[model samples]
Each structure stands twice: as C-alpha cells, then as structure tokens.
Target chain A: MSEMTLVEAINLALARAMEDDPDVIVLGEDVGINGGVFRATAGLQTRFGSERVLDTPLAELLISGLCVGMAAQGLKPIGEIQFMGFLYPCIDQLVNHASRIRNRSQGRLTCPMVLRTPHGAGIRAPEHHSESTEAMLAHIPGLRVVIPSSPERAYGLLLAAIRDPDPVVFLEPTRIYRAAKGEVEDNGEALPLDVAFVLREGRDVTLISWGAMLKETMAAADALAVEGITAEVVDLATLKPYDEVTVLGSVAKTGRCVIVHEATRTGGFGAEIAALIAERSLTSLLAPVARITGYDTVIPMARLEQHMMPSVGRIVTAARKACQFS
Target chain B: MASKKMADGGLPVVARFEVRHRNYLAPDGSINRPLPAFASDANLLVSLYRAMVLLRSFDRKAVALQRTGRLGTYAVSLGQEAVSVGIASAMRSEDVLLPSYRDNGALLWRGVNPEEILLFWGGDERGNHFSGPVEDFPFCVPVGSQAPHAAGVGYAFKLRKEPRVAVCLFGDGATSKGDVYEAMNFAGVHKLPVVFVATNNQWAISVPLRLQTGCETLAQKAIAAGFIGEQVDGSDVVAVRAAAEEAVAAARDGQGPRFIEALAYRLGDHTTSDDASRYRQEAEVQARWREEPIARLRAFLVGQKMWSKAEEERLAAECHERVEAAVERYLATEPRRPETMFDHLYAELPEVYAAQRRELAGEGDV
Candidate 1:
C-alpha cells in the first residue's frame, strides 16, 4: 500500500488496467506528451507507448465519437474531456451512438467505453472550468454516471468503469484531485458499480452526498456528533442506477434524510433522492426530507465560487433541521 | 506591385495540388475514356447492372408502401444507386462500412437482405441486426457523424496491423459539418486506412448544393485535410467502382487516406416525407432522370451486346418477384415484447431497472 493523491490513484489505476488488458487504450487532448493538464495521466505515454496513450486533436465530439467507434470494434477506450464545461459537445455522441448502440443494433454492437472529466466547483478557476452538471448527464438513459469522492473510490471505481460492458460517464471531482491523500493498494481489484457506500453509520439522520461534497458531508457528521445528534453518511457512488436499497434502508432506519450536492437545486439529483424517500420510506419519516445544494443561478467564478459550493456549515444546519423536527 | 521580402528572405512555394475527375461511361451511354480492367468481365458488369435494378425496384416499392401507410417515412436511394453499389462492390468482405441512411444499395450489395431493409423502414430494430457483413455499422441517421466512426475503425485496423480499410458514405450536405472535417483531419494525421465517399446528390432536403457551401466541388474538402480528393461521374457505375477500388487498395497498401466525391442528382424527393417540387423545378428533375444510374448502366450494357431487351425484361421481373417476397417477410414479422426494451439496453440489466422492466411486463408494481 502506498499513500497517493486522487490523481495519482487514477494514474495508478489506468496503468494497472492497461497492463492487464492489451485492448484498453487511453486518449484525449494533452494526454500523451503533456501527461494531461492536471497531470492525471503523467508518464503514461512514455510507459505505455504513444500507441496506447494517444493525444487527440482538440475536438470533444471526435474524442467521444472515436471512443464509441473504437469500443464498438472491441477496444476498450477511456476518453477524457478537459473539463465538465466542455462536455456538451460529447453529449451528442453519447446520446446518439454510444448509449443506444446495443439497443439500436439488437446486441450486435455495444459501446463499452468510459468518458472521464473533472467535475464540480471549489477550484479557483475561470469560467467554463468548474462545473457540476452531473444532473444533465444523469438524465441520459443507458448511461452510467459515476462520481468518486476519495482516492480509494476513485481508484477502484475507475477500474470498474473501464471494465463495464456499457458506456459510463466518470466524473472526477477536480477540487479533491490532490486535496486529500490515502493509502491505495495497487491491486487490480475493481469495486462494484451501481451501489452506494455507507461511510459512517448513525441513527438520528442520514447525510447523503457523493463526489467532492462527501468531504463536507463527513465533516457535518462529525460536527453533529458534538451536538448530541448522530448522522448517518451515505456516498452515492453511482449517480445513475444508484443503490436505492442502501439509501432507502438508511432512510428507513434513520427516518430522516438530508441530501447535499454541488449542482444547482432545480432538477438536481437530490430531488430524485428526495422523491425516492417520499415514495418508499415516507411512512418511516420523522421529518420532511431536505436538500442543501447550489443555487439555481450559474456557478460564479473563483472569487465567489465558495458561496456556490455546499459547505460543512450548510450540511450541518440541514441535518439539524431534519433532527429537530417534531 | 513589388513583392515584399520575408524576414528569412523570400517566401518559398510550400505545396502544389490538383483534383481529378473520372468518367469512363458518359450519361449518353457512350465511352468517355478507356475502361478500367474490371470492365472487361461481362459477368461482373451484368451483376452490377442487376444490383442497380434491384435497388431501384426496392426503392419504388418502398415509396408505394410508405404512401399506402404500410411503412414509415423512408429515405429513398432513387438515383444514387451506382454510388452505393459501386463503393460496396469495391470493398472486401473483411472491410467495414459506415453508411448513411440512403446507402441501402450498399448494404444490399454487402449481403443485407431486402427483407431487412424493409423491416428497418417498417420501424423495427431487428433490421439492424445484420446477419450479413456483421462488422458493418447500422444506418446512421445523424448527418456526418459516421465519419468519425470510420476513422476510429481505421485507427483500430492500423493499430492491430490488420490489412483492412474502413469506407464511410455521406451526402454532399454532410461535408459542411465539423464532424466530417475533424474525422478527415484525424485520418490524415494518422494516415489511417480510411476512404471517405461523399455522394454529392446536389440537394440536402430543401437546400441546394449552392446554398450548402461556396466550394465549387465537395472533393476539394479533402485537400484541406492533406489528402488526395477526386470526383467521379456517379451516373456511371464503371467510374465509381474504378475510383473506389483504387482508393481502397491504396489505403490498404498504407498509402494513407483517400477521398472520393461522386456527383449524382437526387432524382426523387429527399425522402417520402419530402416533396421536391416545392423547392426544385420539374424540368430539373426531368433532366436528371435521363442521367440516372440504372438506365445509364442498362443502356451501356445493351450497347455492349452483353445485355439485350429480353434480358432487361427478365431481370425486371426477377427484381419485382424478389421485392414482393421481401415485403411479405417484412409484413409477417411480429412486434417484439415491450419488456424486451430492457433486454438489450445493457448486457445484464441492473437490479434497479428490473422493477421497471417487471412493471412494463405487468408482473409487479413499482
């Protein structure tokens, strides 16, 4: 086991996957000689050779489309978009070809590709750099939307995403790429997808979050412990086809839920979790579900990005409301 | 005017280029140039003629079926048969084809049955499950998107060291899309084994070629991507096949990517949903009918004494019978079960979606 940042873990996972499977290829802008803008793919091209790690031209649509084609031809491709704000161009290829290739071809052709991009706010960056538009991607049917909150999850979940038989949009939280470090064994084991991880178990309330927001959610649980109120923390690793059993089970035990995210409140994924609780676990509820998320307006630039992101204080306040209710 | 000197002295000429057009058989059924070697095979020429006839027969029946409400809105390859048939005929069985909606003729030549084509137009997904040339891509509805797929396939072939080429077919209007340009640029940069065929059908629904772009010819678009681009008289199957064979062979031999722009006219409306008379003149359509691929090939075949009036009638009858049989098979196919929608969505359905599939099957409540 070695202490590694999230980005390093991602690099380690990629190297492990390529070493294991000759059919796996890594391609994106600046992924070859430059080792990617964030250095997530550092030293990959030199180690794996330029053929396995390719530097594509500056076109997101082509990158995604090439992956779909390559995947259809039996090559496992992991494509990267520099940032979430630039992911719009890929939506066309993802929706039209990648997602529905199997359905369209009636099992004749399948798209087993992964598109990775840095997601969410908190990074002091310019416009079109920090975006948490996971909701937009989750809305696409036939796509698996996954977000890893820590170095360990990032390493394990990325391997799982690459091995998945369908297309996956893997959103890596840029804010925590190097913010935290953890011991990640370089084992080639992949964590299961379409499931959630229960980080901290408690009885008073459930603090649900994923991606970079887990930092604040865990902190809120710690803060709530001081106030004599214990909060359960659940990390929804896979946003789409989420682990409803775990979420509903936690809600059933706690009887209260507080969902947090970095995306805007309107039509956010938090609403889906709230509705799930309302439909299945409403009878067990002690208080109405609450959602603490970004405002409906656009995420501001770095100067004001902190206000747009969910903080530990906000998560703790929401958990308090859920606990204090009748 | 005096020439300005550069910082390093005088500017040197960096590149020189030219575009060539091929036409062995003219629209008047006369030879415009020496025929390629393959034209000597009377049996091959006859087969090409038969394929064009079959495509036209299928196209006419498809339009009638759509009009009678038996089929959904369909894209017809009315006058562009030679372009598709020629390209597909040039490709080996191992080659991959990324075709557009109107390339049914190409698919048929590649061994896809007429019944499957009818099934596709009849709004069934099973049609895309091609039993023939299984590696070929299904019909791409979005314009120019398949170009990138072709490049990707070519890249895979190059990476695997496979001596195979990927052929992509699109329309004149698709040349304006950035996707096509980007794909071409990538293929050129990698020298991928890809051949891009642009069927310049002179119309993109209501828009004309003049309105699509200011370029004089679609073939010139390839020059910007650093490759050879040539035009062919699409009405003459001989020229299209010749150009395609050369390009496919060159790409397979690691000579880099090649582009072909086969100029044809959309002798019919864009699709069953379109009415060409609303945007184009009747006189233009009439003039194009004289240059349509099927009749031109038939006229040339008859002149060469390789075909006759009797053979023409017999081939037409055979095509009609074949098409009717396919229509019967298409009509006999039953609708798939509703729950099957979840079957192919993923290799194995996730447990979460199982409830919805069960609900769709009327087995459980969500």
Candidate 2:
C-alpha cells in the first residue's frame, strides 16, 4: 500500500498496466521525456522504454485516430489529450471512428483504447486548461466516460478503463490531482466501471456528483450531518452507461436528491441524473430534484474560477431545500 | 510549383524532395513504359482484367437494384474499377485493407463476397462483418477518415515486427481533409508499413478536384507528410497494379509509407441519389467513357490475341450470372432484429441500456 496523490496513483496504474500487458502502449504529447504535464506518466518511458511509451506529434486528431488504428490492429493504446479543452480537435476521431468502430464493424473490429484527459477547474490555469465538458463525451455512444474523484478510484478505474474492450474517455479531475491523498494498493485490482460508488450512507437526502465536484458534495453531506439531516453521497464515476439502478435505488430510499456538477446546467450530466430520478423514482420522491451546476457561459479565467465551480454552500443549500419538502 | 536549390555556404540546407508520376499504358491501349515483371504474366494480367470486368458488371447491377428499389442508395465505382482492382491485387492475403465507400471492387477482390458488400448497401449492419480476413476494416463513409486507421494498423505491424502492410484507399477529395494530412504525417514520422492509395476520381459528390485543393498533383500531398509520392493513370490497370505492387512491397520491406494518386474520372453519379448531369457536361462524360478501364483492358487483351469477341461475350455472361447469384443471396437474407441495435453498442450492455432494451423488446410490434 502506498499513500499517493491522484496524479501519482494514475502514473502507478499506467506503469502497472504496461508491466502486465505487452500489448499496452502509452502515447501522447510529452508523455515520454516530460512524463506528461501533470507527470501522470512519470517514469513510464524509462521503465517501459520508448517503444512502448511513445511521444507523438502535437496533433490531437492524429493521436486519436492513430490510437484507433493501433487498437484495431491488436494493440491496447492509451492516448492522452493534455486537457479536456484540447479534446475538441480529436472529437471527430472519437465520435466518428473510435466510438463507432465496434458497431460499424458489427463486432468484427473493436477499439480497445483509452483517451485520458485532465478535467474540471480549481488550479487557476489559463484558458482551455481547466474545463469539464464530460457531458459532450458521455453523449457519444459506444464510449465509456469515466472520472475518478480520489486517488484510489483513479488507480482502480484507470486500470479498468485501459482494459475495457471498447474505447473509454477517462477524464481525470485535474483539480484533485494533489488536493487529496489516499492509500492505493499496488496489487493491480481494477474497480468495476459503469457503476456509482456510495461515498457516504444516509437516508434523508442523496448528494449525487462525480469528478472534482465530489469534494464539495462530500463536504455538503458532512455539513448536512451536523445539521441532523443525513445526506447520502454518491460518486457517479462512470457517466455513460450510468448505473441508474444504483442512483434510482438510492433516490427511492432517500425520497430526495440533489445533483451537482461543474459543467453548464443546460445540458449537464446532472440534468440527466435529475431526469432519471424524476422519471424512474418520481412517486418515491418527496421533493423535485435540485441541480447545483455551473452557469451556461465560458469557464472564466483564474480569478473568477471559484465563482463558476459548484461550492459546498450551494450543494448544502440545495440538499436542505430538497429535504425541506415533505 | 518549382523549387531551386543553391548553396551559398549558408546553414546547410535541411531537406530536398520530389514527387514522381507513373503510367505504363497509353490512352489508346498501347504501352508507354516497360511493363513491370508481374505485369508481363498473362495469367495474372487476365485475372486482374477479369476482376475489373466483374466489378463493372456488379456496379451496373447494384445501380439497377437501387433504381428498382431493391437496394438502398449505392455508391457506384464506375470508371474507377482499375484503381480498386490494382490496389487489391497488390495486397498480400495477410495484409489488411482500410477501404473507402467506393472501393467495392477492391473489397470484392480482397475476398469480401459480393453479397456482403450488397448487404452493407442494403442497410444491414451485418454487412460490415467479413467472412474473409478478420483484420480488414469495413467501408468508411466519411471522407479520408480511414487513413489514420491504416497508419495505426501499420504502427501495430511495425511494433509487432510483422511483415504485413496496411493499405488505405480514398478519393482525391480526401486529400483536402485534415484527417488524411494528419494520418500521412503520422505515417511519415513513424515510417509505418502502410500504403495510402487515392483514386483521384475527379469529383467528390459534386465538388471538382480543382475546387478541392490548389496543389498541382494529389500525390504531392505525401511530400508534406515526408514520404514518397507517385501518380498512376488510374484508367490503366497495368500502371496502377505496377505502382501498387512496388508501393506495397516497399511498405512491407519497412521502407515506410507510400502514397499513390491514381488519376481517373467518375463516369457515373457519385451515388444512386446523385444526378451528375446537373454539374458535369455530357461532352466531358462521353470523352471519359472512351478511356474507361474495362474497354482499355479489352483492347489490350484483343491486341495480344489472348481475348476475342467470343471470349468477351462468354466472360460477360459469366459475370452476369455471378452478379445475379450474389443479388439473389443478398435479397434472400433476413434483416437483423431491431433490438440488436443495442447489442454491438458496447462489450456489455449497461443496466440502463438493458432496461431500455427490455422496453424496446416489450413493444414487439415496434
């Protein structure tokens, strides 16, 4: 067991994946010599050699399309898009090629590739550096959108994402890269994807969120506990193929739900979760689902960034409002 | 475009490059250059001609089927049969093909049965599943999108130390897309074992080659990617086959990727839904028909006393029979269940999708 940050945990997972499967390759911009901007691939190039750890040209489209080609030819390629904002150039490859390869080939060709990118805002970075637009990716069928909120989940879920048969967009929350630490065993166990993890058990109301917003949501739950309102906290790790069963069951028991995310409110994944709760567990709900999300505007630069992100106060207020009804 | 290099003892000039064009057959079915050794074999040349003939027949039948409402919209490979057959003939049985939508001739030559290709155009997903080589990708509809996939396949071969090469076929318009440029760049830098063959069919739907790019030749696009570029008279199967053979061999031998621009004209509408008469003139179309691939090959075969009018008639009858059989088989196959749409979406259906799938099944009438 090793206590590591989320970045270290991800690096460990990548190293372990490369060690286990000879077919697994790591490719991206500066993934080799620089060990990635966040050092998520630190020491991988030296440990696995340049053949396995490739530093591709600064072309996101090529990086994505190249990974698809490699995956179809029997190599498990893990491609990294430096940031979530930089993923726009490669959306064509992901949506048209990677996501459709399996269905388009009718199961003959499968893209066993992982596109990893750091998402969310917190670290006062420049424009296009700290944006969380996982909803756009999750909307693409045949793609598994996964985000890790903690070090242990990052290690486990990243390993699972790499091993998944289909293509996966693994969105690593950049805000929590070093904000938190936990003991992630190097035993190489991959946690199950397409399911939500219950971070805290409660009965009054459920706080649903994923990625960096989990920090505020969990804090809200703790704050609600002190107020004698037990709020259950759920981390929806995998956005696509969402574990609706888990969310629905929790909402059915709690009879109240508050969905939170850092993406815009209009088409945010939180709206999907809220809609599912209303559609599937409407009769069991004591109040209408509350969503605490970012405004529909560009994620502002460093100074005004905190105001754009979902705060614990907002989440707690939403949870309290949901609990107040019935 | 022209370039002049002069050394004035400045910082040593970094690079110099050139693009080559190849054509072995003339417009009048006469030889322009010495035939490559493989092209000299009568049996191999006849077999290639036979494939092109069969493709022309299949293409006509497919278009007829579409017009008769027996099949969905079809992309005709008219006037470009030699390009497809040549690229396919150059590929070894083990090498993989990443073909575009119009490369039905190449797909058929690569062992994908005519029925499977028909099924794909017939709006069936199962058509993508090939019973032949399991490694080859299905027909890519998006322009120039499959180029990167070919690069990746080549990268895999290079990584595994495999002798196989990956061949990508697209239209001239694809060279304008960034996908192809990025793929070419990747292939060039990695020196991947891949061949990018572009059939410059003169038209992408309605857009002419002149409007697509300002480059003098489509083959020169490879120069930007740092690879050898060659052009072939696409109407001459002999020339295309020779260039494809050398290119595929070079790739297999780890000489890196080679780009071949086969110049031809689209004789038919881009697809069943298009009306080429709206954009192109008949005089131009009539002139191209005289230079189409099948007739050129027939003239060569007759000149060599290897084929006669009687043999041509017999071959036409045989091609008709083969195409008819494939159509019958395609029409007889049943469509997949609607619920099966959810089947291949993922390796395993998530609970939410499974629930929606159950809902879909519940409405059996749907």
> Which candidate leads the pack in lDDT?
1
Question: In model 1, how large is the Cα lDDT of residue B5?
Answer: 39
| Over 4 Å off, model 2 | B5-15, B363-366
Error of 1 at B57 (Å): 0.3
lDDT agreement with native, every candidate: 0.93, 0.91
DockQ of 2: 0.85
Clashes of each: 0, 0
Candidate 2 TM-score over all chains jointly: 0.98
Candidate 2 lDDT tens digits, A1-326: 97999999999999999999999999999999899999999999999999899999888888899999999987999999999889998898999999988998888999999999999888999999988898999899989999999999999999999999999999999989998799999999999999899999999998899988999999999899999999889999999878888899899999999999999899899888888877668999899999899989999999999999889999999899888876
lDDT of 1 by residue, B1-366 (tens): 112333236676456567899998888788988999999999999999999999999999999999999999999888899999999999999999999999999999999999998898899889999766888999999999989889889989999999999999999989999889999999999999999999999999999999999887899899999999999999889999999999999999998899999999999899999999999999999988989888888778889999999998999999999999999999899988999888788888888898999999999798
Question: How does residue B62 of candidate 2 score in lDDT?
Answer: 94
True contacts kept of each: 0.72, 0.83
Residue B177 of model 1 has an lDDT of: 96
- Report the poorest 10 consecutive residues by lDDT, candidate 1 chain B: B1-10
Model 1, residue pairs in steric clash: none
Tell me what TM-score chain B of candidate 1 gets against the true chain B. 0.96
Question: Quick one: best DockQ, which candidate?
Answer: 2
lDDT string, candidate 2, B1-366, tens digits: 233334454445567777777887776777777878986688898898899999989999999999999999999889999999999998988999999999998898989999999999999989999776899999998889888889889999999999999999999989999989988898999899999999999999899999999988999899999999999899999989989999999999999999999999999999999999999999999999988998888788878777889978888999999999999999999988777889878888776777677777775321
